[model samples]
Structure formats: C-alpha cells, structure tokens
Target: MIPYVRDIKFEYGAVDQVSPLIRRVVANNPGPFTYVGTGTYIIGRGEVAVIDPGPDIEEHLEAILKAVEGERVTHIMITHHHIDHSPLAAPLKARTGATIYGCAVTKVVEDDGGVKTEAGYDMGFKPDVSLCDGGEVSGPGWTLESIPTPGHTSNHICFALKEENALFTGDHIMGWSTTVITPPDGDMSDYMDSLDRIRVREFDTLWPTHGPPVREVTPFIDAYIAHRREREAQIEQALAAGPSRIRDMVPVLYAAVDPRLHPAAARSVLGHMIDLVRRGRVLADGAPGPDSEYRLAG
Candidate 1:
C-alpha cells in the first residue's frame, strides 16, 4: 500500500531511441538526468533509502515523497557522482532532512560542465554523507552496504541490501549496454578487476542502476566477462589488420553499437588501446592522430 509513486521516464531530452534494458519512465537528456529508473526500494512508510533519486524533476521527487507520505525519509544513497544519479540529492535532503551518501567523485562528475553544452545535464545535488567501499549504514528495514565498483567511474559505489540479498549495480553492470570505460574518470583495467571481484560474491539478485534485477547472477557475470573478452579480441584483431586508429576500428569494433553511444565506444577503445600499450602488445606515442595509430608489438 505505497501511495507516493512517481512514474520515471525512459526517453529523454538527448536520446531518440530508448534501449530495451532500461526500466522506469525517463528521457535521455541533455539534462543531468537522462534515464530515471522505476521500482522504489523504500525501507518503511516514512523511513526509506532511495538508491538513486534521479533528476530534480518536481513530479519525480514528489512521487517519491508521496509514496513515503506520512513517513520520514532517512537516507539518500548515491551509487556515483553521475549528474543523473546525484542531481536530486540536495533538493530531496532539503525537503526531507535525509542524510545523503555518495563517494568522493563530485568534482570529476561536474567536469566544469563542458559536456553540459553537449550532454545536457542539470548539475544539482551533492552528498552529505560519504560512503566508502564496504561501508554500511543501517536503518529500519534495510542495511545498505557500499561496494566500491571502479570502472564506469573511479568512485562509483554499488550497494547491497542485506535483507534482500540484492546488489544494486549502478552502471557497474547493466542489462542493456556494456558500461562505458571513459578515460580518466573510468578505467578499463579496474573494470575488469572489479568484474572478477564480483564473480565470487554471493547474491540472489543484481539490481542494476538502469534496468531490472538480474535473476541469475553468475551467468550474467560470465556473459559480461565473455562479452568483454570478445571485445578485447576484436580490438586486437582490428590492430593486426594494419595500422589502425581508434576511429578506423570504430565500425569493426562496435558493429552493433548504438550510434548515439559511438562516443562512448570511442572512449572504451581509447582505454583499451592504452592498456594494450602497457602490456607491450601494441604501441602508441600520443593521443588520437597518426601517433594514435596502433599495430602488433612485434
């Protein structure tokens, strides 16, 4: 009998086509929040732990408030400093006096708002309580644990709700698309390591940031790992074909990748190329250009 429930949108100000994996009603935006997910995890009528209180949409925030109407919200836990995920933190806190928790990745997340001219993000909200890897905050019906997942973003934190045996994977592992490994902020090497780390953890479900919960955890991990390996091989093969730039491998490396995410695909390619150079498998001199070209190490 939850009354306050806001319908989050999937389509947004930026994206034209909504991917199948994303849940809730949300739009892809030039704004800070692109995809707002559904299924609220309220701890109690008044006391709830909102995993990602997306966008500062009055209606969206109001729905959350309405759902917990007559109840006092105690927590606002952020998985990362992504503008979309953390933008509403401040407003929600001001209204409910809920303690906000997020990793120390805000400055990087706000990146001078250069991309805002392009990505259209409404930069708002900041965490009040900082949560570290393996940190826990317990309240009424839930004990939320932060699991540092560095890949999409170095400070990204995944949450585990002990009572439900559920791991809320925010962009750490998504059902729709392969999470991007954007340089500086996101690290490919760290991503693979985190993937390996999650393999051994016991969890009944994986509640992804963007989509529905994954029922079978291990197979999804296997699929994710295999998918990554396949992409890695593709990168290597693209290199062996001749002197290839990241753009040259774009079509081949991301055959079925969404065109809207071509930039992200480019970012992943850049990260992989850097990793390859480190292992002495490939060679690089500098950023994208003739120097950005790559070939077999030997």
Candidate 2:
C-alpha cells in the first residue's frame, strides 16, 4: 500500500517556506483531485523560479505577486498543461516579465475514450521555453534539471532542485494519492518506465503540486510501483474470468474507492488495458480503449 499523506496544515494564498530555498503558496481551488488546491512553488531567493503557477484565480495570482514583491521571477516553470497547473502562467508572466518554461504544447486529446474537452486540461498553455529531458535552468542561487516524466500527461516534466537534492514531481508522483493515467495521452507503459527512471535517481525528497512533500523517498516510490503492479495483477485476474470492458472492471477493481471518482478510475483502467494489449497479455477487439472489450491472451 502507498503511504499516503492526506493532511497538511497550510493557509490558502500564504507563502510558507517549506525548505531552505523552497517556499509554497497553496491555491484555494480544492476538490477531489486537487486535495487542498495547487501548491505553487517558489524556488531560490532574489532571482527566483516559480514552478506550476496553478489555476487562474485572481486571489492566487495576487498572492503570488505579493510573495515576489521585490524579487525577480526569471522563469515561470510548468510541469504539465493540466488545468489546475498552468492556467495562471500567462498572467503571472505578464505581471513579472518572466519567460515561461516547461512542456511544449501538444495536440489535446479530445476523445481519449473516456473524457472530452473541459476535462481538466489547459488547452491554451504554450510555454516560451520548452524543456526536454535532462534540460537545465538556473537562477541566482538555484539550478533545476528537468526530467521528462510523461505519464500523467504526455508532456509531464519533473524538475530536480540540485541544491536541495529534491524533485518537484508535479503530478507524476503525489504524496496524497495515486495519479490518474487516462488513455491515449496518458500511457501506462510510459508511466511505468518513468517510475523506474525515478527509482534509480538519488533524490532526498519529492514535492508534489497537490499535497505535502514526500520525505521517505525510496519506500514511497517502491510502494507506488508495487501498488501499480497489484492493480495490473487485478486487471489480469478480471480478464481471466471473461472478456471485460473498463467500465465493468472499475467497480470490482476499485470497490473501496468513492463512487464519484469511478469515472476517473475507469479511465486509468483503460490505460492499463492499452498497456496489456501492447504486451500481448490481453487481446482487445480493436484499439484498446475505455469501451473496448478485452480478455487474457493464449
């Protein structure tokens, strides 16, 4: 089981210095997915870099501006183009005169078998500086190396803080819950590969955009990998019984989970099915998708 951290004591819009060189300001857009809203991170001191500017809320934008009152925001970095992660980047850049950096804009997955437009994605996010894997960006006292972790989204990038030996994991890895991997753009095969890549890295901590920091690095990542493998095993077991669709398997797979999140769960199952079909472990009628029926291969 993943050691989940659900509770965090933080006031919305207040910039709290979580580390020697890292400060966080939580946006007040709380929901099922965004636990206590988005945690916008401020890296370095006088000349700083902001990661994940978060949603386009006026109050949150005002708070960010206030937090960096006399400082120079050299870079506005984003992890992905999720609605809650990058909407405020343009406005923040306009105010601070900072160049936006992070994932390049890609084709939006209109119908990935489960969700459609307005599916919590930011379609208008276009970064001024698109960073690929191993890309580095620096400011006055800090340096960040980008690690492309394309799972939660095809363009997801995790920034590593060299000074702190920490990784800003975005939604690739979260302390609060398992990431939702929808099909098409969200690939389970890529997600698993990214997890393996992160496991071999030497990082002391992981700071997720939604929840509290993950301090026990190795065990946490190991648990995450194990949890995903268990989910895959469950999928295999479900397929062994007979041919099944993602919508039919979700209730049995996530019986303990809240009913409201079942839709998202089904999408994640579709990601797994796609991976299974590619590996020849499962056979789909056509292209693996949310509605496609699948069964164990011979």
Candidate 3:
C-alpha cells in the first residue's frame, strides 16, 4: 500500500504551528515530487533554528521572518542540499546572522550514462558548519543531532530533534510518496542502508520536508523497507522471464502506476538493477542506462 499523507492545506507563506516547538511555512513551489512545496520547519521559539529554509523564495523568507517576530534565529540546519529544501538559508542567514549547517559537499558515483542527475541540488548552498555523524547544535530548549543517512542523495543527513523526539527525515522519508531514487546521484544500496540506520534511531515523529509529519516511525519505516524489497523482487521476476531493457521493465513492473510517472519509475528500476548487479544476482551488458540490456546472473 502507498503511504498516506495528512491533510495539510498549504497556503504559501503562512506559518502554521505543527507542534509547540515546530512551526512550518510551506514554500510556493509544489509539484509531482514536491507534494506541497517544501515544508520549511522553524524549530523552537524565542531563539529559533530554521530547518530547510526552502527554495530561496522571497515570500518564504518573509513568512519565516514573520513567524519568529520579536525573536532571533540562532542556527539554520538543512536536512540535505535539495533545491526545494536548502536555498533560502543564505538570505535567512543574512537577515538573522544564524549560522547555516549541513552535511559536507556531496561526492556522487557517476552512472554508466556518464551524466549526473541534478534533480534536487542547489549549487550555491554552502553550509557554515559541516556536520559529522552524531554532530549536534543546541539552543534554549532544543538540540539537533545530525545523523548521516545517505540514501536519497550521497550527502543526505537526517536531524534528530532531541526535545521533541522527532527526526527531520527530508527526502529520505516522505509521507506523501516514495522518494525518487534516481541512480548515479541516488543509490539503492545507500538508500536501503539509510533506512536501516533510521530503524535503529529513537524518534517518535518523522517530519519530512514534503507532506505532513509521520507519527508512527517504526511501522512507517518498515513499510518503506518492504516496499523497496517488493519492488526488487518484481524486477527480479521480470528479468527471469527474459533479457529486457530498462524501458521494457517499467511497464512490466509498474503497469498499475501512472504512465506519466514511468520515467521516474525507470530510474528506481535502474537503481535496483545496479544493486542486483553488485550482488551478483543480475548481469548488465553495459553501463546501466535506459537502453542497457539486463538478464539474470548465471
């Protein structure tokens, strides 16, 4: 079953309190991938830390400023370098003098296609502080501990809010839809590993950058894991039938899915095939691409 999202009326630039410590301002950008734009989270009151300032939109900046009126911003923590999540940090930092923090610059593995996917990258973003695993920042009543969970992208990190028993999951875990694992930049191996990493963490609520907050942490993650595994099995079965190209596999595997989403689905299929190749369960005739031929391993 697909994940269900909470009903959130996204009025652009309006700050809504999600919890006592968390207020959200949705950016104006929304689409098939970005369910309701990006949910820019304001953590803590008085002196706050803004997580995922979101897409450098002026109105979003003004909304965030208005949310923390009569207060100061201590730090700006981004979950990852996704465009919809990180661009506004510069302006916010300029206005509030808050230190911006994120994981180090991403080092991606190039696919056989020899083209890197710039799906969610913001080239101009440079975090003031680069966090290591278990790194942390503190404020009046809140503390954010960075957990390196590279899956959605090589540099993706999930921040755990100590005060609220919550985790800012970013694209690693979203309530609206399954994350797009576009290969070369997005790895199935890393994504699965990150999911396993999150499974061991202590977080009651998962506040994703898109969609509403997920309260049932373990079950939701388990479902995500199962979904990927099931998709992998479907791909494996398809390969067992005969030699197939990536395009040929998409309809066979995702026949029930919207044809419009097939391009995205093909990437995820390629990601899974790459993982299977690494595991010696599948054989790729050449660098895996839309036209690459595949068959079951001997």
Candidate 4:
C-alpha cells in the first residue's frame, strides 16, 4: 500500500496543507472513523473555487469565510454532490455569494441507490448551476473544464484547469483508497473510461476531493489502472480454485487487503463477480445475495 501523510494547506479564507492551491478546513462531524472529517480545499487562482466544503459545521463555514476574506470567490464546485463533500455549497453561497456548479446526477436528491447522506446529517447543499460533460468555467486567468468521470458515482466529475495543468478529481481517484464502484450510482465501464481519459491528458497535478494532491498525476493514474487490473486477476484466480462465496474468496483474493476493510473488499468482489457472470467466466447462484453462489463459467 502507498503510505503518505495528508498535510493540509491553509490560506486566504481557505485552509492549506493539502496542496499548493488546496486546503482542508476541519468539519464538525468528523465521521464514523477515528481519522475522519478532514474536509476539502479550493483549487486555482487568487479568486478560487472550493470543492467539497465538507460536513456542515458552523465554525468550519465561518473559517472558510475568513479564509477567503478579501478575495471575490467566483465559483463553488461540487465533486459528486456527496454530503460529506458538498453540504456547505448553499450555506457558503449565502455567506460569499458565489455561483455553485456541479452535474445533474450529483444534485439529483438521492445518491447511491437511494442512500440519503445529507438528510440524516446537516450537510445538505444544492447547486445553482449543474453541468454535464465538456463544460467549461472561465475566469480572468483560470479556466476549468468539467471532465466527466462517472464511476464512484455517475454524477462524479473532475475539474481540469487549462492554464495551471491541474485536475480536481473528487472521489474518483484519491491517494488513500481505491474508489468504490458501488453499483447503480457507480459504473465500472465509466470509471475505466475516466481512467483512460486521465492517461491521455496532460496534467502536472491532481487535487482530489478527499486525499492529498498527486503532484505528478499521470503516473498515479497509470498505477490505479494497474491496481484495478490486478484486482480483476486476483478475483478470477480465487474463483477458479473452486466453487466460492464472497466470504470464501476473501482470503485467497484479498488476503493482503486491510482486515478492517474486508467489507469494502467484499463489495468490490460483488462488482467483480457481477462482471464475471456477464462475461461467462463465472456463474453465480446468489453469490452476493440469498442463495447466491459462484463457479468457473467455462
């Protein structure tokens, strides 16, 4: 596993320590884990664009306002409309009067098979302008293209800065964890295509919604692609060993995977098994559901 300290960068109504143009303002609700609620940062230009304001903490929002004290904040961009990432958009707009931009899929009210994140939590914020693919946001010296990167969520889009050579990759590609392709909202084909898009693009840095910026991005993207491919092989091997269940494949397929993250690993295995069934490489007898089972297809 790649281990790195995710330092936050704070400046101008925005917090830094995350990247050259990125910042992380600590939120109120840290989250379900020990090291959580690190929030997110703004990317590019003196008049910046904030990505994922994080959970709604009055202090955090106030800190953001203070961080961007004198700067005329132009835009508030949503990475995927996830609560932990976006809840502050509306409130911040009330505070700073900046236009919010995101995708239709993101602000669609429900995320990931009707899972309500913002409702239970106070992190709900909607966008003023929701965009689709190939859209551009131009300011005086900065221009960001809305690059569609639908995988972690169909609404998930990354922002590409033209002049600065940076991409704000929401949860699409983070330094800490492989993106979870949780079905319905997430699609494997779209995620792979998004990875392909990054491989062919020219970008010096990556500002992800969650983790730290990957200074040299292309290599990390390549590595992500390789990681996914490797996982695919591992799944197939686990299947061929004999008839199996997600529980059965866990040890053989992800023995080296973090024990604490087994449930997540199981989710990935579910996606893999679904794909394998489609390709006729494996048969499922309720392997992921009641009576679900799996075996070598051919």
So what's the TM-score on candidate 2? 0.95
Q: Please state every model's RMSD to the true fold in angstroms.
A: 7.2, 1.9, 2.5, 4.1
Per-residue CA lDDT of model 1 for 174-235, tens digit only, reads 66555667666667788888888777886877766565457778877888888877777888
Q: By TM-score, is 1 or 4 better? A: 4
- TM-score of every candidate: 0.79, 0.95, 0.93, 0.81
**What is the Cα-based lDDT of residue 229 in candidate 4?**
78
Candidate 3 weakest lDDT stretch, 10 residues: 110-119
Judging by lDDT, tell me the better candidate of 1 and 3.
3
lDDT of 1: 0.65
Clashing pairs in 3: none
The digit string of per-residue lDDT tens for model 3 on 133-201 reads 659898889988999888788778889998888999889999888887876667889899999988898
Predicted structure with the largest TM-score when compared to the true one: 2
After superposition, candidate 2 runs with Cα above 4 Å error: 111-119
Estimate candidate 3's RMSD in Å.
Answer: 2.5
Worst 10 residues of 2 by lDDT: 110-119
Q: Cα deviation of 199 in candidate 3 (Å)?
A: 1.3
Model 4 RMSD to the real structure? 4.1
Model 3's lDDT to the true fold?
Answer: 0.84
**Model 2 C-alpha lDDT per residue in residues 1-298, reported as the tens digit of each score:** 8999777889998999999999999999998778889999999999999999999999999999899889999999999998899999999999989999988756566743544312278888899988955589898889999999988899999999999999999999999988888766788999999998898996999999999999999999999999989999999999889998888889999999988778877877888888888999999999886678899999
